[model samples]
Target: MEMKTIYFAGGCFWCMVKPFDSFDGIESVKSGYMGGHIENPTYEQVKTGTTDHLEVVEIIYDDAVFSFDKLLEIFFAQIDPTDAGGQYMDRGTQYRTAVFYTDETQKMKTVNYIESIQDRFDKPIVTEIRPAEVFYLAEDEHQDFYKRNPERYKQEQIDRENYIKTQKNLS
Candidate 1:
């Protein structure tokens, strides 16, 4: 009854999925592209940084089960907002971190949330807080990438790759 949605572009979409899915009230987490000018852009065009599209996840949740603030907290905990250029090993506009607010309230909440956590870091938080744009769902192959690519997922787990690197670089 109290459903809401939010968009987060945090580096690799593959690694971003599981974090939000773990929380309650998260009805769905869809990996897609947003904040771009093109229509229904392809993964190749976005991945190659040829388009303005950002790789983001669209999260639908029930506010009664989990507050948006809690979502922001978990999101900030996972990403290095201080990184201006990009996040972790992924270096490109598509890999950049951002919060695409669907409404004025979401925008205000995001700004306030950023202010609350600003003091925690020495450098400025470069995580862009902007209005939500058109979302283009990625190819089916990209959906639940970690689950689909078990061998790569297993290797990633064995190496502790993305998460470890992201945490280490966070200020």
Candidate 2:
């Protein structure tokens, strides 16, 4: 099986893990920070929005089973692509949506997918597509947050789902 990795910065890292975790061929979904100037940044530093780092998830998957295009669809579904400021109630540069492509193929697929779905939204898509950078793993407590903090994670999922519904209605 061919393995490939890609990074996605979708609002809260806590809320990002479960969506990709349950899927087959998805070897791992790790919570982390990326696209920042600082090295080995802590959650405290990144949350303050001073580090220029975005909360991201490092997804390792088998390309033979899970196509990058399918991954893009899943990623886009969880985020409001038009929201440049942040996602849902989370407002900050750290919470902004982005895709850190690992190679030219991933980059092209992302760009093409965005283009294909552009007409679906009234506002322009603002999700940034950048080359992959050093991804600093978040503290242990932050990883698998959904599983560890089920109540809190459920609340977050509710909030995000409600917001996504509204966005779909608006479109």
Whole-model alpha-carbon lDDT for candidate 1: 0.86
Which 10 consecutive residues of model 1 have the lowest summed lDDT?
156-165
Evaluate residue 134 in candidate 2 and report its C-alpha lDDT on the 0 to 100 scale: 95
On residues 127-164, what C-alpha lDDT tens digit does candidate 1 reach at each position? Answer: 99989988888889878888789788576555556556
Error of 2 at 93 (Å): 0.1
Candidate 2 Cα outliers beyond 4 Å, as residue runs: 162-171
lDDT of 2 by residue, 74-158 (tens): 9998888999888987889999999999989999999999999999998999999999999999999999999999999999888
User: What's each prediction's TM-score?
Assistant: 0.89, 0.94
Q: How close is candidate 2 to the true structure, as a TM-score?
A: 0.94
Candidate 1 collision pairs: none
